[model samples]
Target: MDLLEKKIYIAGHKGMVGSAIWRHLQARGADNLIGSYSNDLDLRDQQSVSDFFERERPDIVINAAAKVGGILANDSFPFEFLMDNLRIQNNLINSSLDQNVERFLFLGSSCVYPKKADQPIKEEYLLTGPLEETNESYAIAKIAGIRACEAIFKNKKKMYTSIMPSNLYGAFDNFDLNSSHVLPAMIRKFHDSKINGNQPVKLWGTGSPLREFLYVDDLADAAIFILDKNSHHPLINVGTGHDIEINKLAKMVQSVVGHEGEIFWDTNKPDGTHRKVMDISKITGMGWEPKVSLIQGITQTYKWYLQNINSLKMVNMYI
Candidate 1:
């Protein structure tokens, strides 16, 4: 199984995580990589997905496409978050199985774990308790995707596996304040405030929640590691196995962006999860570990944000 020569299809090749994987694979000299944008192929359409799989006949498929957002967006559009993600992953997973794809890697978030799961959440705690109300719909959709991949691997004897990553932020991230995740959102807020004469930045929630974040590039490397090893683990967790408080993270981002502004915590808003850290022993034991530290990753992300601020603004407007 020379993956470098196999045709690899990354479903969300244009996203932060998918693009990172594409870049890494290219750097690794993978020849025969394939990808399609939403305009070219709507993953939600079963016939369209099936047709694409039939035509492309990819030897490997990485399911990275999904409807993603922060708590505000998830709370506002639960149905779209749930249905759209379900449709996209379902079409891709089912199509890959039917087409006899050699390898499939499904990517999901740490949100798939229960809201009140033990700190440093482990894989076994998956459906032990209720999910956070704000993103329950999205979590349910991801849970279904993980279960689907597990079922196919167990019953159909396929090489389909799922990796649950902690909160990810890096290049190509969504920086829009209204819909972006906490890390990128903090970067944007700090950068904007820094440029605006160090104006006070308002952040959502009490800044008390604890979270773990992985750089998108590290996640991509983990994906490639799994592919190369042909790991048969039905589900694995990918993260730094470290957690930080929102308030501390805010200060870190503020320092990275050089924003000399006061950060005001909006107690009115909701902190979706009190603590959501992944137990990465499974992946780490398999010779894969995150190389990017939070501060270093944030530094790079802020640099990218600075270079692409105008383009990001246009993207937000279009969205």
Candidate 2:
């Protein structure tokens, strides 16, 4: 089926991931793309999602909506992190199955993998061991979502697939320090410190943990590529197959933000995971590659953060 002619519903269209997908679909001449703000459609509510599906009758559904945050936010609100995500994905997946959607794509994070897995985590390593304590609840919810899609693909022979992306950052990313991921949070901290006369910036953790990040738009492209492919794999990892230490990442973000401040590491804070870099052979072998490098993506995200700082501040207040 041609993707352009189909009605595509992107849940959480305003988020970093969903917005990127929405723009890409629009650029590809997908006029029937559909979305709703949380105010208009509470994805956590099952009946509302069902009603929206019945009314729109979309041919395709992209489940990009979820309750997401950083280590501090996840630790503080474990219940919301788990239950809200469970409710949101459950409603959308159930509605898509009921509507008999032609294609369904579930977006999950690399956090679904185990904490102490191999250096380069593989899809087969999921559930092999324990998860990071900081975001265990969020990871479990995502695991459930992935398993749900896998079950549908196996039993019902439906095109229900899940893409597990590495840490993502780009335009429309959550920049609130309390809840934003490590990258965007670093970006905000450095920029704010630079603006404040290069004051010393205090960062959490000992800056020893390693992480792999992907540009949200690159993940969007991968999503579209995987959606159009003829693969039978229900789960695939999307990443750059590269890892960077937190200290190096901090220095890079400081340079990008042009911050001349001294960075102070708080050793008391917990490092969520020692290292996490996904094995991207599955997607790259399928002819999908990430176009944005870490430095390039960071520079672009800093530019966006600068341009939208005021609005982001306003949005952070309520988030």
Q: Give the top-scoring candidate (lDDT).
A: 2
Give lDDT: candidate 2, residue 75.
98
Please give, for residues 128-221, the per-residue lDDT of candidate 2 as tens digits: 9999998999999999999999999999999999999999999999988779899998998888889889999889999999999999989999
TM-score, predicted candidate 2 vs. hidden true structure: 0.98
Give one digit per residue, the lDDT tens place, for model 1 in 1-319: 8889999999999999999999999999998999999998999999999999999999999988998899888999999999999999999998998899988999988999999999889998999999889999999999999999999889988889999999999999998777899999998888878888999999999999999999999999999999889675889999999999999999999998889979999999998888888999999999999999999999999888888888888768422
lDDT of 2: 0.93
In candidate 1 the C-alpha lDDT for residue 17 amounts to 90
Clashes of 1: 0
Name the runs in model 1 displaced over 4 angstroms: none
Q: What lDDT is reached at residue 94 by model 2?
A: 95
CA displacement after TM-score superposition, residue 27 of candidate 1 (Å): 0.4
Overall lDDT per candidate, in order of appearance: 0.92, 0.93
